[model samples]
Target chain A: MKGMTVIVKTITSWVKILIFLFGIYIILFGHLTPGGGFAGGVILASSYILIMLAYGRDFVEENLSLPAASRIDCLGAFSFAMIAILGLVFGGSFFVNFLFQKYLPGQPLNLVSAGTIPLSNIAIGLKVGASLFLVIVSLSICCKDFRPGTSVNKKKE
Target chain B: MIIFYCLLIFMLIAAIVAVETEKLLSSVICIGAIGFGASLMFLFLRAPDIAITQIVVEVLGLIILIRATISRDLTFITGDREFFEVVVSVVIVFVIFLAGIQVLQTLPDFGSPIFAQVADAPSNTYVSRGLGKTGAANLVTSVILDFRAYDTLGEATVLFTSIIGATVILRKKCRKKMEETTG
Candidate 1:
């Protein structure tokens, strides 16, 4: 059983690495390609799911506790909302792009040419990553039988 | 015409997958793919703004649905009612396709003079003002923040609400049970 677990873990780790790299590619080329923050984030979350499935719920819970993930989700959302609010303070409308000036240095049609767009992509990437992680974690945890004393009582009483 | 045919094929495949899958999780995944394809179609039709919004909302909705379904262990379709499901899904898809083609046919072309005039005037004015005043290089930023600040505020409120909702929904029910027993 232990050996089987290790094999599964190795496979899952490779899959996670592939997904993580694919997500990076999507976000990096979001401006010029069809992929963007939303797609990239989903890909990132699938990595976490792979880890969970391969290693079991206890392993995932130990590594990425529900509380820690929830906090990250909250923080990511707050940061994104705060950035949008900053525009109001700067006398811009709402999501007023106040972050950068010139587009990033590349050809006009290059993937890296869009300046603030990439920043938006990053912000969205973080938000989606953390939130989707939390969602998956919450689902898995909720489905688990975590109630105390039930099994103990069955053994004793 | 080839592009249109390609889109039609993709849509058909998506619909078929969404209907034929026995596992609910796989069905949900297929639906999400359909949403992505629809967004791509929107972009191809020169509606980038709609495409972005569609992607955002569809992703969020899919995540929420997946979470709910998984938590409840509702991950498989049951019964010998597969035929019924397939027929119903086909009818629904056909109705939507008819409406979609009708709308597409009636809509004005992308480069129509009316759209050009509207886009040139408002977006140009906003871009110049944004550059002059806001010191931002992105035109969409100026339009969203400076020209339409109120919408941004509303968007922030929407985010806040979702955060609160998630917290409430995911709170530990066992803790409440323990508190009830102690009280």
Candidate 2:
């Protein structure tokens, strides 16, 4: 997991942050833009994955560990549920746009005016990002250890 | 248009190459080319949301596919499963077959429309009143996060469940290491 050559590493260091920011832009401006939470979240995960490719899996696991990713995954799901339930509590039924209806109803085509859309986008983005990352990381781990006809990696515990 | 035809042809060629290639890694990359071509087609059709999703998901999928294939031999998955797996899969397939028959029976007749009145369809309603109701310029966002919020919720839950399943199935080696170190 020592990563690629100096050239790839340098280029990735320069470009990963930009990709991360673009993902955030997509998620935040989803109400006015073409991309939404899922797209942005995939981009976000790929930014980290780009780093993984250039700097190796150990570097990534150090920055964002497996346990921490799982935690974020849980937190993202919990926050989305909280948002939906908040709509039910404040407004009438489930998933009502409570902000647009009751509180802080702003004009259209403006940021900070999509009511609960942006909040939901952010929650979904977090959930999707963490989920994809976890899947890739776990699959990589399994693939690395499970060589054909090699049960040596497994020890009876 | 010519562009549509070109992309369609390119994708068809790429799909053929991906299927017929001898090198597994090259095949995986060709699959990625087909995905990108589809993404471009989506863009041409004025569906940028789907285009963005397609490209990113393809990138992630390509990474996973390449990683899974990079260190494998040709003889890697040739029927090394346990007897338990064999029995379980048979049961699962039988159940799914029954469910599929029931589902096919319940499906509407061919060429039947879900909505009798096109104007009353949910998409039309979303397009007409979405801007005022949700104050979002993007109709897709408003529909996904507001009108059909439950669907998004279900999607997020599905993603969560999949990650949990992956971790549970694949982390046994790490778990064993942790236990030995703790002991």
Candidate 3:
């Protein structure tokens, strides 16, 4: 039974890795393809769900505590907001691209040319990832009623 | 046009399933599926931003509904007037569906001057800067972070509010228990 559990976990981890990699591909190709941060983020979160299903709630809690996930979520949102505010501080309209400087080669349509687009993508990816993680974990934890020693009722001896 | 008709048919089926289902969980899932279909329709209508927002909001709403429903008694009666309600709902759905189809057929395409003006105006600054500064190939990022930063701020606030609400509601029982133990 223990070995079977291990085999199942291994398979789940592999599936999760594949999903994570696919998410990365989607984000990387977001500009050139149909997928973007929102799609990629949900896909990544589904990977985490796969692991949780295979390994159990304890495994997930051990790897990603609710507090830590919450903090990451807050930080992601704060950073995205900060980036927008930075544009305003730079004498540009809110969210205006004000910090981009011309790079070497000056080739347009190249991967290294867009000024703030990449940063925005990263910020969006972070926000989506954190939000999805928080959502899934919160839902799971709220429904975690079958865990041992979680009840307050006592039996009379 | 045929694809549009198919989508309309599917949406009608989804709505029927959502309302007529006896089980709360099934109803919730069906509603969520309808939300997904609506978002897809939004994308087809060339409203990507609205689609993304709708999808996220629907997912969050579904999660909340599921959590709330799980704790409540969801058994309800739909007495003799059930058929009337179903007929009324189908009529409402068909009316809205026909209106949507008509609107889509009549709306201006992307080549219109207003769309061109917005696409070519200062917002294009993101595209230019994105090519010149950010080294990223995605134009959406340029628009999101550079051209419309304020909207991103609002989105972040929405996320923050959602997280806070989820934590507060989910922690209530734990807080009550802690107070009882301390008292």
lDDT by residue for model 1 over A1-157, one digit each (tens)?
Answer: 0123777888887777887888777666655555565566666666676677677766766877867766765665666667667655662656555544332334444454533455555555666666666666655555454334453465465
* Candidate 2: pairs in clash: none
- How high is each candidate's interface RMSD, in Å? 6.3, 2.6, 5.2
Which order, best to worst by lDDT? 2, 3, 1
Model 2 residue B26 CA deviation in Å: 2.1
lDDT tens per residue, model 2, A115-141: 899999998898899889888888877
CA-lDDT, candidates in order: 0.63, 0.87, 0.65
Fnat per model, in the order given?
Answer: 0.05, 0.92, 0.39
Once superposed on the true structure, which residue ranges of model 2 sit more than 4 Å away at CA?
A150-157, B75-117, B172-183
lDDT of 1: 0.63
Q: What TM-score does chain A of model 2 get?
A: 0.93
In angstroms, give how far residue A87 of model 1 lies from its true place. Answer: 3.3
Tens digits of per-residue lDDT for model 3, A37-95: 66666666666666666776667778878778777777767766676677677735566
> What tens-digit string does per-residue lDDT give for candidate 1 at B62-136?
865675565454477786767888799889989999999999876667556343546666656664565554433
